[model samples]
Target chain A: MSFFGPGHGACPGCGLTIATRNVLEALEGKCFVSNSTGCLEIVSSQYERSAWGVPYIHSLFENAAAVAAGIELALKALKRTDEGKVVVFAGDGATADIGIGPLSGMLDRNHDVIYICLDNEAYQNTGNQQSGLTPTGSNTTTMPAGELMPGKTGRKKDMISIAVGHGIPYVATATVAFYADLRRKVKKAAEIEGAKYIQIHTPCVTGWGIDGKQTLESARLAFETALYPIIEYENGELTKVRKIKDRKPVEEYLRIQRRFRHLFKHPKGQEIIRILQKIADDNAAKFNLDV
Target chain B: MKKVVRGFYSIAHSVKLCKPNVIAAYPITPQTEIVENLAKMYSNGELGDCEYVTAESEFGAASILVGASAAGARTFTATCSQGLVLMSEVLLNAAGMRLPIVIVNTNRALSAPLSIWNDHQDSMLLRDGGLIQIHVETNQEAHDMVPLAFKVAENPRVMLPFMVNMDGFKLTHAYEPVDLLDQEIVDSFLPPYEPPVYMTTKNPLTFGSYAPPHCYAEFRVTLQNAMMRALDEIEKAYKDWAEITGRYWGGHAVGEYTDDAELVVVSMGSLTGMVRDVVNEMRREGKKVGLLKLRTFRPFPVKEVRNALKNANKILVFERAVSFGYEGPVGIEVKSAIFGFTPEFYSFAVGLGGRDVPREEIVKIIGDVYEGKVEQGFHFGTIKEFEEVVV
Candidate 1:
């Protein structure tokens, strides 16, 4: 299963590399993939032997979805649209930020493909810069640790909800922590008609300033604290939610990562904790997350 | 073979003949009637096996057409000035991807002060886009242009999509009878579009990949070469189409009605019809004059133009749009096209922003150019207050 062994160009505990390698491991068929120009592409595709085990291509940041859409149509003309799942491997910088129009168009037009958004918060490939998915109170290079206010101005955008609104048949949320769930979600998405979107939370080690080995735990914390609630919408409606065994307070989640260390500047940490709680509460109200 | 029809209906009827598998268009004035007729044509089984998406916006209409075209379907869409500008990005994407999509552009004036009238600004603005642009004059020409456009665009050697342009309100709403071609002939002439690749997860090929600076530059140059190849492909299509209809309405790839004369006038789009009338009047008067009607602008048939103007002493260019702060765009291009070769060129930048250019003005232009009264370079169709310039 671990075709990408220890010797890799990625950072010691780069969650994205692990997640992408693990993500491709489930493919039993020869699939064509479009990779967005980001950290995943830069590290994995160094010159000759791209870490990609399958046929992987790359395009511009904004046109990732459009490129994949083209490949999908090409397969259909050849009567091979169903042979393998055409997927786009892009990050938050490419997905929610730039490639939204093409992605939304593909979903609406019902292109037969799967698009995976490997969310590592900020634009990690460009050196710990803020992105649309970067949450509030998280200090990055742009949103510096300051005394007056927090790191990111607003909360992370509701991407999964927007994807659902596009009326794609399958839309889900997963994390690198839950390998089994991530694989299952991707597989399920590929086996359907029309475009599918899956958002995976892979904590960036350098950006998050956390222990490399603690990547999985950080992913788990995102879910347990409900800071990054995992939910799915099928055919434009709420259909599934991943069950969290023991929900923890948002403080326990934020206090672990150095990115969120700014919130701990005050001992009480009451306001930032409530803000995280409000995010979770809003999501719960919005999607009615039972699990 | 002729039937009485409105300009817009001519376009709609011609679209029906091609039988586009997907017709994604939203109605906008000066161009709405055609799609309205098409939406009906698609719905009534007259145009069979087509997906007619009544899009929410011009942007959606454009994107939908791109998706449908990429999905290996022969697609059609119609838009005017604002709509065309709104769909600008997808238009570039469509041509860049070599989609071979044939779209109808009802040429309308771009708005800021919000004026919707006949102008070539819309199509002229897209002259640099990698697509064959054919301007049609009459309703019959509009009808005839569609079939040939599809054939040229989908040519394997020149897989550049084409946009057939007609003056908006001037032509789109003007009802005129056209000798519509038999659908069987159109079907036989225009074979179904089969793109080299389409959207599929299986056997995915790289499309729209960022070629590192070196490859990127080469790709652009190659695209330019393909556009050049389309000239021959379009001529070939015209040759084949002529056999069926016994009419080569494409006339000259770069039109020249009476080229072997003292002076030559140039025009494109419905304006050509006006030029033709003026030329006929001048011919009867024993005045040795000719008219060069530009049909295909993208390939910019410089060689043909030079040859047509070879015998002529004075060559006048009547442009419908201005480049602002410069001479007319068409005049500039025509001048650049014939750069090294010297000709007594008079660029009459006229009929801009829906301003009317009467036939008398056209006659006066020929008279002035011949008399050595007109400026040697660009003129804004200005007339001496001695008289109002006629067409």
Candidate 2:
């Protein structure tokens, strides 16, 4: 659907732009959206020019889920729930960092709304600052690779598990490369009657220091290495897992992005890469992603 | 119907009368009773057709109201102290989006000694947040102001959020006899909230968009103009509300008893009641002292204040919160409003951190200001005795 219109102020091949478009397309203009302050909000709805044809609101960074919850309840209060589904479009920073509390609140209240986290893994809107979702061994502006310390020291937060733990009706993870899978998940989540969450592995061309054309390729690599598993859950139960038909080593995924360039060159680089590989292996083992 | 009720219950009863479709709140002290009563009313089916959400945090409470308001519902919330500070970001967002959500802010001191005491610090922090801030002295006024606040805030000319501030614990826990309006009057006075901008499937529109520097300034100017226009809108609401309810606080941003006075005392919130009492005592004693109570702090009522205070030989200002290293927030605003007036000015910071502002001190402060004793800048009223410890 062209509801998520073109000519948005996003970087070329920005996976977030693609991801948001896919979500809106999946909804097919039958939803009211609440956007958090992030790359998507900044790029798509700047002033007089709006890329969204659907009803939308961009209110604060950390309260998209909370706002969407209100929208859902308000719709119910007005006896207008049949009007459209309510959805929150936010970033990893919004869903996993500062906004996590409000997101948790929304899920706990079980508002009939869908929350989508476009996980670019850093604060791309603020020029690549470190976020809770910035994976370990990855370099962000605030977590620069230095002589004293490596990249982001800790592993990325397990936001999926957090959402699932809330006992919400539906939770899923998708990527821009898996358009059909992403659209299918978004549509299914929107159709569900209770709180839902979808975390899409959105790759940032500018923030990730990758060529714009490699946006999909990078997102695909993230899944192929089992670093970001494309999985779905219903009512706290794992329902489906997108098996990796051809698994690649984490290095293939890391090598293309400059954020991990220091990991390949430093004396401790190889060890860090091995640890990252182990992480992917663990994810694969846990989610049964390997074919 | 008049009932003897705690201040928080009065707030709850008033909100119930307005029949807000959504009331989202996170439990915070002093303000908790208001939501507690609201939840009870919802459960008992006394407050009909309302969704009461017990949000996880103050942020959740405020954000829920913002979303609910944007989705075209008459939304309400109650919070104070840390809760108000926590809701600060959304407070700004609610105004910027012109959502017209009504929030009752039970004023309390901020933390770092972690005090839950009554103070003006919380509401004063959001003075410029593009909301119609109405600070009421009595529980009755707090109750009366809710529907009027909604009317003013939702006015097409002033599509801004509204905050009604009552002193936490001091007023929220105090008991008062309030003549509550019936649901019929409330419903008629405050029509179902219908916003021009909202998230509806039938008519799609984007709200809270990113404005470039050029567009951002215009939006801010619009908000400023809207806030300015709120003064008249608020008066109009008062007039309409008075016609139906047969109750009207004077139109000059609250009652001004300054017509036949040689000296005038200024204050806001619950402090005004005591200030009025002191003025009455002085009047009986043949002293020409009167009180100017500020009800609408935002849109500051500059002209009314100047008119009421211009004739006085001296003006004494008492405020409940300090801005730290400067005059009290209300005193500073009063100074800015009456800039050219030649009255002997004394700005006193009193009752901070919930310290009692004894009636004698108010009398003494007035006496000092009249006798040319008090200094011009920020004066610590009762805390002056414990200067070493306070400073």
Candidate 3:
């Protein structure tokens, strides 16, 4: 009983496609979804055709959380709370950049909503622009690897910690590579009574210049290298972490993607690679990701 | 039923009587009292089954209303000036989606060298944003326009967003005698909002879909047709409310006083009150002067405006907002409405940025226009002499 139907216009091996399907399937049609302006919304809900089998709305780029909050309050006000949960799907740019203010307001209001940030790391829909979630040493159209500069010069914003700082009832991180784990988080978020936020590491094949079939492989490498931690929090307390049995090096994750291919050729490439490794090391230490 | 109250309190009471399901608004000066009063009502349990949300920004407030309205709830919010500008994107989206939401805009000047005072520049900036815009003259009219706005907006034939514009500090802060509508009468006038289609799990629906170039213009045409249809809905709402309360603000759109008058003053918002007084005083002196209060700004009331001013020899179109390089917005629309009817039309930008439109100023502008002392084009009504500044 999946709500996200097929025949949509997502690119081949689109990670958002897999994450959207997994989240909707976990909800089992007992949710109303609002989408921000992004690849998922444009592809799934073009006029005269919609891929959503559940009630859906796409208002604007930055107001999905606020809109979902309105939906939650409306259902409560209309005495239709038993109908379904209210969920929002926004891209990383929508979540961390243009939409952060409204998202924080929604969480601050503690509306009964599940906000899912489809973190493809960059604005993949708009041809791979640099987003707040774009990691360091990643090449994007806006932040290209020129002679003087390496790749992106900043680290990915720690959005999970920001969500936790809002003191919501539930906050978690998942990856599209791990469908079962992502589904479990969705179900748990649905069961929570207050605001819930989940940031999914949905790797972008086009943006990362990876092969179409390597979307899931890239997602797996992201988590396995400890660069994208899979962790959960309940009531602002860390409750779960996906520990790695044999943690891979960050070089293995960076080498396959063309976004980081420039890092190996540039004179200052090794230093940036070392910086990326230290980020992964910090995440592993912070989340206790070792078996 | 008559009580003296601030304009914001009157608007708040009117909205409460209409029984909105969701009220999400952020506080802005002059517009803050309306939501604050509503919040107080909600806290006091006067607003039954209503969800009151204090949004972080006007964008959030307008977006919440859009979501609630899409979910089949009667929703509302209020904003002005910069706040209205912030909510511009979501407001257009709501109109495109044909969501029947009512917004009360306490008109204020736009910023740079910021002024929170009364002006129509805010609402005028969104003149073509696909929302039904109606201006009010006094606090009493502002109170009456809320339920009427909701009725017209929720009319299945209309199903468009409505914006009721009232001057910021002029009407919002001023106390006036208002005859509040009884809840029973309001409930009978505006039935429960039953949208044709809405977001529900039992029956899924998609809203705000992406339109290709092949069909985008058609959707916009549909919205334009909805605005055109709103004219009739506004008339019907006005008729029904007048039937219940016996208070008619105007006929269709323009409230006219052109009884065989040659010079007719055309204006909207609270400035109309001062113009009305000036016209009455001039009429007592046997001068051929009259006033046309523009109630509905959007859907321009073209037919009514042309009909009302066709007999006049001189038409003075006064407005509080300018269109920058062009003339006053209302003045441009008026000239366009009666293009062929050459009646020596004069455009005047007056009372801008909270400057007071005194009765003397109104009389002086009319006198200047009638005497042919001012040009036929746009003219600033009152400009103070410049003072030396030691910058």
Candidate 4:
């Protein structure tokens, strides 16, 4: 049985929706889900209509992990831990920025739950606002590239490392393009007993100003360019990596998305391009993502 | 048996007797002792089969309790001041989802100068959060109200959250002789929570979902109806507890001694204890004055308020919080309740931020009202030096 159904409020070619579908499909419909306030919550469960067939709760914007932890503890209190899986869904803004403290607390407490963050790099639901996960040299509503300042100043927050630092049993990164890998990671997290975190690189067509059909292509290029590396860690130990062979240059990924189009315009644009390439190079070196 | 204990221990002892399945809390000043005592009990095996969660923040604690309560477990939490403010969002979510969670809000002031002192502003901010707000007078009532709050909130007719407001530091730190009921009696009085519906895998259902305007208004109306129904449930719970323990106050919603009195002073929470003493002194000296204590603030008890104050020749409202530029929080509601009545109304903003309003100070304010020296609207008795300030 499918947990998440089709035909809801999700936008066309929404990468987060694709990743959510793949994750829930891997669960085989035996789970209780909690969602933080974001696009996924707004789109999936609007008024009388619900896209989720499984038991679900949508709480505030930054408390999904805590909510899921309570559910897990409640199930344990009722002696029904084996009956279902407890999972939490949140966006990058909720996970990396506003919700990081509670998310860290849940991991510190070692609750039996899975926290999946659909990282679209920026806040796409509230009209593409800037978030902590917004990458450098990308335009968001709050951090627009103008004559005065560049797109975003800093690199995206490294949430995988934060999860690993909590000494959780499992932490992984995946992209929507790698459906098999995403499914495998979700299933693996569900099987674990302690806190598990999986961050999925979800490409947003509207936020990035790309064609709806180009969502998958952009996700693939993200992986190839080492901008969104697929890495897995088990109990603070790096266990798996998706190495890139014939690694594509960061230019290929940047050219298609208009969020980064301004990086090719002004005299300062070339320098901003170099900064973006350095981020990719650093990730490639750190995760050994290049062949 | 009656024992002299800090007000915080009374709350902890009452919670122990209530036997909640889960308690998730973060410590804030004036509210920390209650959670600390519970944590000690959980560690010492005195609190049985309860999951005591020490959350990262007040927001996280409130969220945890909401989830636990929605999952069909009896849940509790305690917080004050900024902690309560931080949990404000989760409070609305819990109430909207109809989770019968019980919380003790040690009332404290919001900060610009950053003081962890007593005031009603914290709980006043949550007046419309759809939870039952009960203000307590004595430490015994603070103890007694815990089980009562749980019973009323978890009742099938209500099924809404409840908040018990006790003045921060003033009552929370005071030592008093509280006659806590026997464990057996408390157990029989407040039964285990059995929610009609919950979040579970067996019977899958969505909670806290997005509601369109059509569906949203109905939920709000339903919640309001539940609040109204809670008045009866609260009385029933109190009556049932009184029948077993022989400790009945006038009513669960309000208590008044306005009969045969010309002037009535209205107030709530621990501050009422001081007001009651002052009124008693004034009565023994042959003054025609009485006291009206508001026990319930959310369901408002508007009818009781109007009925209690209707016969008085003059009415005065003493409260610990202000509505910024307007009257005191409770004062405005009291005025609305008695709109058609013809008592010369006066409101005094007093005892804010844990400022001790001694019996002499209360007597002076009453004395001013008696001599017709006070104006028709609001007055600040203690802060007269800065009465010219906007608030």
Model 2 DockQ reads: 0.88
Tens digits of per-residue lDDT for model 4 on A1-291? 457866477878999889988888898778889898988898888867888888899988899999998998788777777768889999999999999988998999999999999999898889789998998888889989899767988888889889999999999999999999899999989888899999999988889999989999999999999988899999999999999999888999999999999888855778888887898998899988888
- Model 3, A153-225: lDDT tens digits are 8889989989999999999999998999999999999998999999999988889999999999999999999
Best by TM-score: 3
DockQ of each: 0.21, 0.88, 0.90, 0.76
| DockQ of structure 3 | 0.90
Docking model 4 quality class: medium
User: Over the stretch A106-184, how does candidate 1's per-residue lDDT look in tens digits?
Assistant: 6777777788899999899988888889887778898776766567768788888788888789889889888998888
What is the iRMS for every candidate structure? 5.5, 0.7, 0.5, 1.0
Which scores higher on DockQ, 3 or 4? Answer: 3
1 or 2, greater by lDDT: 2
| lDDT digits (tens) for residues B81-196 of candidate 4 | 89989999999889998999899999998998787999898999998899899988889988888988898999989998899999888889999999977789888888888889
Candidate 3 regions exceeding 4 Å error are B387-391
Model 3 lDDT tens row, B1-391 = 9999999999999999999999997999989999999999999999999999999899999999889999999999999999999999999999999998899999999997799988888998898889999988889998888999889898888899999999998989999999888999888888989998999999999988999999899999999899998887788778888898898877545645676888889988888877888888888888888888888889888999888888888989887889999889998998898889989888888888888777788888898887778878888878988998999
Model 1: fraction of native contacts: 0.09
Q: Name model 4 segments beyond 4 Å from true.
A: B252-256, B384-391
- What is the Å distance of residue B115 in model 3 from its true position? 0.3
Report lDDT (Cα) of residue B192, candidate 1: 76
Top candidate (DockQ): 3
* Candidate 2 lDDT by residue in tens digits, B5-45: 99999999889988898999789897999999999999999
